[model samples]
Target: MQKAVQLEVYGRVQGVGFRWMTKLVADKLGIKGTVANQADGSVKIIAIGESATLQQFIGAVKASPSPSGHVTKLIQTELADVSLCRKFSVVG
Candidate 1:
């Protein structure tokens, strides 16, 4: 089944390569969505893909942090409407 989720990653996520790394992970996982730095110093990710793939992608994101980034918390919320993104991207 296809699924979409909104994730808020907290702690030392901004100012690092978090968004870029996330995009790379998403691409590798064949997921589509956007990753951006939030004003509150969090990294926001909206990903759409297979349910199992999404779970793996999320785990990868949490486990693999950027060299300068540290993930302290991850909050995930399921989205009812998938964005049907064509590709993963790093957005500002």
Candidate 2:
């Protein structure tokens, strides 16, 4: 089933190529939506795709691209549908 997940990834996430890493995973999983840096020094992602795909993407986030940007937390929730995304983007 399709699921929409809102993720808040913490730990030295900003200015660390986090969004690009997220985009790589999302694109590889065929997921779509957006990823960006929050003012609180975390990364936020709104990803929509199959439930299985979402899980896989999350796994990658936990493993982050940089060793320093450890994923301290991940918050996820389901949206009603995937009718809003055009493509995965790194929005400010």
Candidate 3:
């Protein structure tokens, strides 16, 4: 079954190619959603895909962040409603 998740990644995530890297990972994993920078200096990612794939993607994001990015805290929540997106992209 397809699942959706909202991820709030904290720490030095902005201005460090985090969004770009997230896009790349999402595309590679065949996931669809949007990644954006939050006003609270965190990165927010809404991803939709198979449960296993989403887990892998989230693992990647936490285990391997952008070169200059350091993910200090990661908050994940399963979204009950899925918003299907055409493709994964970086959003404002």
Candidate 4:
């Protein structure tokens, strides 16, 4: 089933290519949502798609970026953005 998940990755996440790399993951997973840099030095990622795929993408985030990213935390929540769709993007 399709679902939406919002992830907030903190700690040196803003300046890196986090959003673009996340877009790559979402695109590969056939998911939809947006990723952006917040003012609080964090990256906000939102994705909607099959639960399994979403989980896989999350795992990717932890694994691939784990080496360079000192992720202090990864928080996931349900996306309530009604305007969300099936194409991932990088929001300013």
Candidate 5:
């Protein structure tokens, strides 16, 4: 089953090429979503894909794709009313 999730990733995520890493991971996973830097020093990701794929995406993200980035916390919320993007991107 397909699903969507809004992820709030905290810690040394901004200015560490986290967004680009996220896009690479998402695209590789065939997930459609958006990754943007939040003002609160967090990275927000909206991911849409198969249930299993989403889980993998989350794990990959948590593993810190960006070598310079550190994820102190990751909060995921299931989203039911989101517009799926055609591909993963690094949005503002």
Candidate 6:
């Protein structure tokens, strides 16, 4: 089944290549979405993909993108009727 989710990731996520890593993982998992940095020093990810693949993507993201980065918390919200994109991107 296909699904969509909006995730607000907190802790040491900014300025640490978290968005880039998210994009890489999303792409590898054949997921499409966007990752952006929030002014509150958090990373926001909107992903759409297979139910199982999305879970895997979330796990990979929680692992922290870079050694210098740490994922203190991850808040995920299931989204309905979200705009679907063709690829994953690191947006501002």
The number of the candidate with the highest TM-score is 5
Q: What is the per-residue lDDT of model 4 for residues 15-86, given as tens digits with 9 covering 90 to 100?
A: 667677778877888878888888888888888888798889888776545345566788888876535775
**Candidate 5: count of backbone clashes, pairs at least 3 residues apart or interchain:** 0
Winning candidate number (lDDT): 5
Once fitted onto the true fold, the runs of candidate 1 whose alpha carbons sit more than 4 angstroms away are: none
> Model 3 has how many clashing residue pairs?
0
The models' CA-based lDDT, in order, is 0.87, 0.84, 0.91, 0.78, 0.92, 0.88
Alpha-carbon deviation at 17 in model 3, angstroms: 0.2
Poorest stretch of ten by lDDT in candidate 2: 65-74
TM-score of 3: 0.94
Query: Residue 22 CA error for candidate 3 (Å)?
Result: 0.5
- lDDT assessment of candidate 5: 0.92
Q: Model 1 compared with the native: what TM-score?
A: 0.93
Screening candidate 1 with a backbone cut-off below 3 angstroms (N, C-alpha, C), the clashing residue pairs are none
In model 4, where do residues sit more than 4 Å from their true spots? 64-67, 80-83
Against the hidden true structure, what lDDT does model 4 obtain?
A: 0.78
Per-structure clash totals for the candidates:
0, 0, 0, 0, 0, 0
Positional deviation of residue 19's Cα in model 3 after best superposition, in angstroms:
0.2
Q: Which candidate would rank higher by lDDT, 4 or 6?
A: 6
RMSD (Å) of each candidate, 1 decimal: 1.1, 1.3, 1.0, 2.1, 1.0, 1.1
- Total residue pair clashes for candidate 6: 0
Segments of candidate 2 deviating more than 4 angstroms: none
TM-score of 5: 0.95
Write one digit per residue (lDDT tens) for candidate 2, span 1-92: 87888888888788778888789878888999999888888888888888888889888888885655677787777777677797899999
Better model by lDDT, 1 or 6?
A: 6
lDDT of 5 at 89: 86
